[model samples]
Target: MKKSLFSKVLFVCLIIPSVLTQAAEVNVYSYRQPFLVEPLFNVFTEKTGVKVNVVFAKKGMAERLAREGQHSPADILLTTDISRLVELHDKDLLQAVDSETLEKAVPEKFQSKDNTWYGLTMRVRNIYSSKRLGQVDLSYEDLADPKYKGRVCTRSGKHPYNVALVSSMIAAHGEEKTLTWLENLKKNLARKPQGSDRGQVQAIHQNLCDLSLGNSYYFGNMLNDEKQKVWADAVNINFPNQANRGAHVNISGVAMAKHAPNAKNALALMEFLVSEQAQQMYAETNMEYPVREGVAVSALVSSWGQFKADELSLETIAQHRKAAIKLLDKAQFDL
Candidate 1:
């Protein structure tokens, strides 16, 4: 009887731990690449003892989340780009959580109006110019200069970054003036806007275009690649519109699924992410700026120097997105 009671107690101890482990697990579906977001997950699991199950897809996370609905097992949604985040909110797939931590870490412009989503990291649309040249002129309007005609390269205008940049112009000017700018800008492209932003930098090395518009991180990432390093090394990265409203910027952020299976765990993870440790990892690894104040920018990013970012509430950017996209379509900015 003594041995029997001892065995039963031991069994209970083992099974209880397993049950508790299962209870703490959070299932996440992320639009960000695995490498980009998994580190944050690992850190969260380490700190909270919550196990994470992740499903990574390059696109269609929104549709998948919608299809899953209340039956969905996803407790968290992590993605890049504002449009998709806005889409999920519009679809009613996100739930608002009252986290004072998130509010303190993220700015009002970088989060959803209802707190359904929150921005984690920020990036800028910047100009890359030749260092061999005299003084660098940093202005978005410089692309329209006749000297830059046939010397400008960029990624797809249909891309969200470009769309946001164009949207900023539309906000500053108006639809008619923004359309004319794009029309002339497209005519001046050295070659058609093709390939990724990195491709635009490569065009700079090849002398295909004297100036290119691309994400700030691409410049840092290229510093590690052999062939690409040549392109990145030869150029000077500049933040345009410094004396004016500054460069166009966007953010990569997160939200909790409306029917989070592990709502508590999801909130804990969000809190951990905005913490300084995770924000540092986010900035150093991704070459992005932490949304929180006083976290130093990455060395690579800082080297490019600081410039103003359009202070338009990011929500305004999202609000104008549909109109901006319509203008792009009308301007025939396909290339």
Candidate 2:
């Protein structure tokens, strides 16, 4: 009887390592392009011996998660924009992360109130102007100025990026004022609101419009591209309202999936993503600002000079998303 008990104990010890080894992996569902994120995962794997498996998708993450329910394999969801993260929370596709590391690394303004999502990096919604205009200083509110009528260009107001911008507007100026701002800004469009942010820069290059709104990273990206560098050269990147409330900002962020099969490894990955090593990689590789203070900005990104970002809580801006969309529709913004 004693020999049998000893054998059972030995057997349990032998299997535990095997189980732990098999469990040392995290699965990810990423809305971000693979090229943009794979390197960070590679480094995390090197450091922790935890394998990361990614299923890249352009859309439908929410629907997929809902369908998969409690059996979903995805442990982490990496996505861009506040609304996307908020959508996951509202849909109950995410679970709260109670990591002290995350709470310390990310600012309260950039994380969900319930700690379900944490911002990884930041991008400014900058106003770009033709060099001919020479260092234009304007606020997001100034886009409505009749003086610039028929001289501004932008992507669809309904695009998530612009929608976030409009939400910030509503937070700053309230519904009625933001709607009027949207209508007047629409009247200033050089052509119909159209094309990608790059296309708006191209409009400035071609002299079709004198100013357009675009994310700050697009400037660095355009400068790196062979064809787009010329377009990048045509404009000066402006961080608006520097003297007042400061420029509006947005983020690319991550969340812990509701049904994470590799729960421990998933939490580890989330913690690593906010680590100094990962934050630095994001800044250098993606031309974005690290959410963690003290991570260095790339030289090219730094050359554009620094400006204050509006410190309003992202949670507050997200609350205004529906209102922003409503005003856009009521104003026939894209039309």
Best by TM-score: 2
Q: After best superposition, candidate 1 residue 11: deviation in angstroms?
A: 19
| Local accuracy of candidate 1 as per-residue lDDT tens digits, 237-312 | 8888888887788888899999997898888888988999989888888788899888888887788777788888
Q: How many pairs of residues collide in model 2?
A: 0
Candidate 2 pairs with clashing backbones: none
TM-score of the candidate numbered 1?
0.91
TM-score of 2: 0.95
Question: Residue-wise lDDT of candidate 2 within 90-209, one digit each (tens)?
Answer: 999999989999999999999998989999999999999999999778999889999999999999999999999999999899999999999999999999989999999999999999
For each candidate, what is the lDDT?
A: 0.85, 0.93
lDDT of 1 at 52: 87
Each candidate structure's TM-score, on Cα atoms with residue i matched to residue i, is: 0.91, 0.95
